[model samples]
Target chain A: EAGVTQFPSHSVIEKGQTVTLRCDPISGHDNLYWYRRVMGKEIKFLLHFVKESKQDESGMPNNRFLAERTGGTYSTLKVQPAELEDSGVYFCASSQDPREKTSYNEQFFGPGTRLTVL
Target chain B: AQSVSQHNHHVILSEAASLELGCNYSYGGTVNLFWYVQYPGQHLQLLLKYFSGDPLVKGIKGFEAEFIKSKFSFNLRKPSVQWSDTAEYFCAVSWDYGGATNKLIFGTGTLLAVQP
Candidate 1:
C-alpha cells in the first residue's frame, strides 16, 4: 500500500498571499489529520477529517486558515493572507479505523510541505 | 489542556553509545504515548507507542521506551546508537476524551546526532 503523499514539497510565497497545501492519504484510510511545526516550536495539530466531515477543527489558529476534505479522499489546507509566522512544515497523516481491534491503526505520515512566507 | 515536554533539545553521542531521551506530559487521565522520528529531508515516522499493558515497549530499529505512570514520563532508550539514527525525535500524547475524536499533543523535538 502506498503511504500518505503530499504535493508541492516546498512552497514560497509573499506575505498576504494565499497558498493551498494538498494531501493525498492512503487508500481505504478513513481518518485524515493535519499538523504543522513552526520555527523553534512543537508540531501542533490543525484539524481532522473522517470521511468528508470534519471531526475536529479546534486546533486551527485563526480565521485565515481553512481545511477541506471534499470527498473523503484527500485533504487541502488553505492559508489566506499568509503571515510570516506561517512559514513552516505542514504534515498530513492517515490511519485506519481506530475502532478496529485487530489492527493497531497507527498513523502513516506524508512528506511534509515546507511553506516559506516572506 | 494537554501538553508534552521533551527535556533535551539536542543530544550528541558516539556510535555504539547508549542513548536516552526524556519525555514528560501533563494530563490527569488515561493517555496514549508515542515517539516519532524525522530524519533529514524526511517525513516524521513512528518510532514507538505505548497504549497499555506492559510499561516497557519496544519498537522497530531496536528502540524502546519505558512508561512510568506515576512520574508522567515516557522515556526513549537504545542500547547502542548508530550514525543512521541521527534524527529529530518528538514525543506526543493522546488523551482518551471519551469519544471517537483522538488528538495528539506534541513536544518540541530533540535533535539527536550519533557520531561515527
Candidate 2:
C-alpha cells in the first residue's frame, strides 16, 4: 500500500497568483483531509473529503481557498490570490474506515508541499 | 473551542538521556490524543496515540505517552533518546464524537534536538 503522495513538493507564486496542490491518497482509502501549517504555527485542518463529497469544510480559512476530490480519488486544494501569509507547508492525509468502532483510525500523511507566496 | 498547548518550543538533550515533553488540552468533553513527529525534510508521522483504556500508551520507536484525564494532559516520554530522535513533535487532540468526522487540533509543536 502506497502512502499519500503530493505533487510539486515545493511551489512559489506571487501574492495574487493562484496555486493548486494535489494529493493522491492511498488506494481504497475513503477519507482524505487537507491541512496547512504556516510559519511558526501548528498544522491546521482545512477540510475533509469522504469519497467525492466533502464531509467537512468548516476549517477552510476563507473564500479564496477551495478543495475538491473528484471520483473519490485524488484531491486538489486551490488557493487564489494567495497571500504572503499562505506561504507554508500543506499536508494531505488519508485514513481507512472512519466509522468503525475501534479507536480513532490512524491517518497516514504525505510529504507536505511547501508553498512560498512572495 | 478546543486547543492544544505544548509547553516547550525547543529542547536540547544529550543522547541516551531521558525525554519528556508536556502537552495540555482545553476541551472538556471526551477526546483522543496523539503525538506526531516530523523529521527534517519529512512529513508528520504518528508517534503514539491514546484513545481510551490504559492511559499509558506505547507506540513505535520505544516512545510512550501518558494521558491524564483529570489533568487534561498527554505527555510524551522516552527512556533514552537517540540522535535520530531530533525532530519536531506535535501534540494533537480530536473530540470523541463517537467516531464521527472530528477534525484534529494541533499544538504549536516542540523541536527536539538530541545531541550525540
Candidate 3:
C-alpha cells in the first residue's frame, strides 16, 4: 500500500498569485486531512474530509483558502491571491476509518508541498 | 483552545547518549497522543502513539513515549541515540471535532542533532 502523496514538492509563486496543492491519499482510505506549518510556528490543522463531505474546517486561516475532495479520492487545497504569510509547508494526511472496536486511527502523512510566496 | 507544546526547540547530543524530548498538551477531554519524526528529505513518520492502556508505548526504531495524564505530557525517549536519529520531531494531540473527525494539533517541532 502506498502512503499519501503530494504534488509539486516545492512551489514558488509571487504574492497575489493563486496556487493549488494536490494530495492523493492511500487507496481505500476514507478520511483525508490538510495541515500547514508556517516558518517558526507549529503545524496547524486546516480541514478534513470524510469521503467527499467536509467534516470540519474551523482551522482554516482565512477566506482565501479553499479545499476540496472530489469523488472521495484525492484532495486539493487552493490559495487565492497568496500572501507572504502563506509561505510554508502544506501537508496532507489520510487514515482508514476506525473500526467500532478500535479507538485509534493512525494517520499517514505525505511528503508535503513547500510553498514560497514572494 | 487545545494546544500542544514542545519545549525543546533544538537539541544536540553525542551518539550513544540517552535522549528525551518534552511534550505537553492542554486539553481536558480524552485525546490521542503521537510523536512524529521527519528526517532529512523525508516526510513525517510516526515514531510512537498513545491511545490508551499502558502509558508507555514503544514504536519503530526503538523509540518510546510515556504518557502521563496528570502532567498532560507525552515525552519521547530513547536509551541510546544514533547519528541517523537526527531529525525534526513533532508532538501532536488528536481530539474529536463535533465527535465526527479527529484533527491533530501539533507543536512546534524540536530539531534533534545527534553527533557521530
Candidate 4:
C-alpha cells in the first residue's frame, strides 16, 4: 500500500501571499492529521480529522490557517496572508481507525512540504 | 504542558561503534511512546513504538529502545552503527485524554551521522 503523499514538496511565496498544501493519505485510512515544524524546533500537531469531520483542532495556531478534509480521503491546509513565521515544513500523516484496532494505531507520515515565506 | 525532549541534538559515530540516543518526556499518566526515523530525502517512518508491556522494543534495521517508566525516558540504542543508519530521529508521546486524542507530542529531533 502507498504511504501518505504530499504535494509541492517545496513552496516559496512572498509574505502576505496565500498558499495551499495538499495531502493524500493511504487508501482506506480514516484518520488524517496535520503537523508543522519550524526551523530548529520540535514538530507540533495542528489538527486532526476522522473522516470528513474534524475531531480536534485545538492545536491550530491562528485564524489565518485553515484545514479541510472533504470526503474524508485527502486533506488540504491553506494559509492566507502567510507570515514569515509560517515558513517551515508542513507534514501530513494518517493512520487506521483506532476503533477497529484494540491498540493505538501507528501513523504513517508523508515527505512533508517545505514552505518558505519571504 | 506535556512535552518530549531529546537531549542530543546531533551525534557523530564511526561505523561499528555503539550508539545511544536519549529521549525523555514529562507526563505522569499513561503514554504511548514512539521513535521515528527520517532518512535523507525520505518520509518519516516508524522505527519502533511502545504502547504497553515489554518496555524494551526492537524495530527494523537493528534498532531498539528501552522505555523506563520511572525515568520517564525512552532511549534508542544500537549495538553497531552503520553509514546507512545516518538519519534524523524523533521521539514522540501520546495519551488518551477523555477519548484518545491521538495527537503526538514530538521532541526536537536528533541528527545522527555515522561515519563510514
DockQ of each: 0.71, 0.76, 0.72, 0.75
- Which stretches of model 1 miss by more than 4 angstroms? A101-104
Residue B15 in model 4: shift from native, Å? 0.6
From the highest lDDT down, the ranking of the candidates is 4, 3, 2, 1
> Which rank order by DockQ, best down to worst?
2, 4, 3, 1
Q: Which ten residues in a row have the lowest lDDT in candidate 1 chain B?
A: B95-104
Question: Positional deviation of B61 in candidate 3, in angstroms?
Answer: 1.1
Residue-level lDDT tens digits of model 4 in B1-116: 98999999999999999999999999768788999999999999999999889999999999999999999999999999999999999999987554645889999999999999
For candidate 3 chain A, the 10 contiguous residues with the lowest summed lDDT are A96-105
| Model 3 vs. true fold: TM | 0.97
Q: Please give, for residues B15-83, the per-residue lDDT of candidate 2 as tens digits.
A: 999999999999668888999999998888999998889999999999999999899999999999999
lDDT of 1 by residue, B63-114 (tens): 9999999999999999999999999999999887666666789999999999
Better of 1 and 4 by DockQ: 4
Docking class of 1: medium
TM-score, prediction 2? 0.97
How accurate locally, in lDDT, is each candidate? 0.92, 0.92, 0.93, 0.93
After best superposition, candidate 1 residue B60: deviation in angstroms? Answer: 0.9
Per-residue alpha-carbon lDDT of candidate 4 for residues A1-118, written as tens digits (9 for 90 to 100): 7789999899999999999999999999999999999999999999999999999999999999999999998999999989999999999999987554357799999999999999
Which whole-number lDDT from 0 to 100 does residue B57 have in model 2? 97
Given candidate 2, what's the lDDT at residue A82? 98
Candidate 3, residue A70: the lDDT equals 88
Error of 3 at A101 (Å): 4.7
In order, the candidates keep a fraction of the true contacts of: 0.67, 0.81, 0.81, 0.76
- Residue B43 of model 3 has an lDDT of 88
